[model samples]
Target: MEFEVVVEGAAGALVAERAGAARVELVAALVDGGLTPSLGTVAAVLGALSATRVFPIVRPRGGDFVYDRYEAAAMEHDVRAFAAAGVHGVVVGALTPEGAVDRPLVRRLVAAAGGLPVTFHRAFDVAADPRAALEDLAGLGVARVLTSGQEAAAIDGAPLIADLVRRSAGRVAVMAGGGVRAEDAADLVAATGVEELHFSGMAAVPGPAVHRNPRVRMGGTAVPPEDERRVNDPVRIAAIMAAGRAGAARRARP
Candidate 1:
């Protein structure tokens, strides 16, 4: 019955708050599947969105969920950093070489998080089996699990997500995320019977690079190339918020 918007920056957090989101998942390098944000970025987002809780992501690197000892150490450091900085929660997950949830590692990180909750990130999607992974995460006492239901997108995996919700049965919270758009969020919620939804309310922002660079001309060959970057846009955030609210409303209706 609630939506949590993932904010790539302070701007996105501000928009999420204005649009009445329950919480903000803060991260930097959104292009890299959301690595931990800088201290300044975290502080700015926390300060800016005083009302909305900020859950700083603790992903040390993008790409695969399997992390080496160094990366594991780095993720732990990030977890400690976020806890010290007073984040409401930390979003993180790690897998073993065999693609099973690293229970011991996750337990240590969850303890390092202090009193803040630990949300097992979408790395759960890549697990060998989502149902088994959910049981493992539940046993580890993870507060929540963010997943795409083992499908490419939440909508595609709604049936599985619904099953996950039913299987979890309050032992742990099941949050459906990944490729969740405004229009389809309600359907996802209804199909999956999940109470929490997550999405990056982003839009393409104008590039800072100029169309042409005279200093870089080579052999009288100058060709302009198009570039685009997706960043948090307040307008898009509002729209996503509207969609989530509409979904909640529909679900509440008799």
Candidate 2:
């Protein structure tokens, strides 16, 4: 099984590469559930990475997957920028008010990706029908779909993920993500039969602040000041990768 680690910047990308991750999903403001990263950050990550693929998320904002004309246009511009930066792919998805894949708008974004492969992000999890959305993504020639089967965690949604894998029939890759951990990697993959897994092996690291401000907050929500800085822990990432590979090997045994 391949591991796709979610990273925020160049430092995280380097950590992922060193930790044996196969790919990195570059994003910004992960606390907001990941938004489109800046072009400079993308360029830095691309330059720092050696073999690991970079698939930057093209979301203009967090909250909902529903996008308007302006957001769609911005996403297109970002996609083009990523392609020009020599990224491996882009992670993108759009939904309608009824929670269905916005095929027409997604088609336009995919077209903007040029020849790069696209991975429909977890927006599929909120769709009205998983099977229907899988079909639509396949029809769009998406290389993969990152989902947790509409649940808070992939293990909790393993049954639906398994069904999605069976229904996909190799037409599109079903990547199980959301709260993936080293301990549960085997069970999730064994149950879902997924070839890829996505996770953010992140942990809270202390920031370099001599004096702390108790009344200031950079985020919209209230979070502990010390918990604001999260970084990719290579040890955690390596453990997850090792556990996932071991599980895959175990399943392959006769």
Candidate 3:
């Protein structure tokens, strides 16, 4: 019944830890669905949190899951670096042109990770055949698979997620993620029999009013304002954690 928070920077990590997150999946450019965070950001988060484990995402870029040779090599290097930096684990994913798990690249990344566990990211949800992809990942000894059962929101994919959980049979951990809401935490857990849940738990807050060039945006119109930050909220995170634990308990009751 552990909660994993998806966070971008040190501030978000601290918020997650305060809300009882067992661990966090650290990344950058979360608006791009999370890119690799700099080592400096990782260090800052590691220095800030005492109890919560930091597992930084090793993604090279945010586009498609299918990566080129250079991108794959960079991912391996990042995994090894994160391992040396004392991260608990690394989150990563790769797919072939045919939309299947890239076993060769993933195997290399896992080897570079040394003793650290590796989590296959949501790219599993986009696989041509999720069931077969899961089998491939499990065979490669991937520690876990984060997916929404090929749906945009985990709640919508509960049935497929539950089926995956039953099929896993403890061979690999099946983590439910993707638009996971606090209100649905207990029901999602109870319905899917998933022990791990992942979500951003973020809220947009106005930042310091020290900006002069408001007209010049760092990103496009869709991106948050330059002075606004999207950060994890402690209240939402705690509620989800409490509800998830309760759900686990209820299911355990014979």
Candidate 4:
């Protein structure tokens, strides 16, 4: 089984790699559902890990997955930039006004990728029809899809995840993500039969104790407490991987 962690910086990437992650999806402002990280951050993460694959999610802004033409162009440019900086792959997604896969834009992004594998992001969960959306992505030659089966958590959506895996038939990889946890790893994997699992092993710890100004907030109403920061914990990550591997072993039993 392969484990992929969503990380915000080089530190988190190192922690994930040390805890046996096969890949890391680099991003920023995870509070905003992950935004395109700066190129410098991308370079730092790539330089920090020797073997762990890095797939940066290219989302210019959050709120909605529907992107305008300029945002589409920005996404394409970001993919090109990340590719140039030596990322293993890039994660991206877009949807039409009618809640379908934006095929033309994705096709252009894939072409811009120039050969690196493209993993469609969680926007597939929002598409009106998941089965047809999977086919559309496969037709576009996307290498993978990150989804929670349209549920808030992968374990809760195992049935759909399993269906996608069966439907894919190895043509596209279906990675179970979205609000995944260490405790549910074994059951999720055993039920879904997914070889790849994506999650963020976030545990809140005290941030800088010194609060310069408690009244001032960087993110306005959406700001998390400045006293603590959520990060991928190594111990939790290792445990999750072990649990997942156990599930995989059970799955392989004749």
Q: Rate the local accuracy (lDDT) of all candidates.
A: 0.83, 0.90, 0.90, 0.92
Residue-by-residue lDDT tens digits, candidate 2, 158-217: 999999999999999999999999889888887788999999989998788878876677
TM-score of each: 0.89, 0.96, 0.97, 0.97
Q: List the residue pairs that clash in candidate 1.
A: none
Q: Scored by Cα lDDT, where does model 2 land?
A: 0.90
Candidate 3 — which residues are off by over 4 angstroms?
none
- Residue 142 lDDT, candidate 2, scale 0-100: 92
In model 1, the Cα lDDT at residue 58 comes to 88
Candidate 4 structure quality by residue, lDDT tens digits, 164-250: 999999999999998777788889999999999998888888886774667777777776867669998888888888888888988
Tell me the deviation in Å of residue 52 in model 3: 1.1
Q: Give per-residue CA lDDT, model 3, range 165-248, as digits (tens).
A: 999998989999998887888888999999999998888888878755778888879788788888898878888888888878
Q: Against the true structure, candidate 1 has what lDDT?
A: 0.83
- lDDT for residue 56 in candidate 2, whole number 0-100: 96
Best by lDDT: 4
User: In candidate 2, where is summed lDDT lowest over 10 consecutive residues?
Assistant: 219-228
**Candidate 2: residue 147 Cα off by (Å):** 0.7
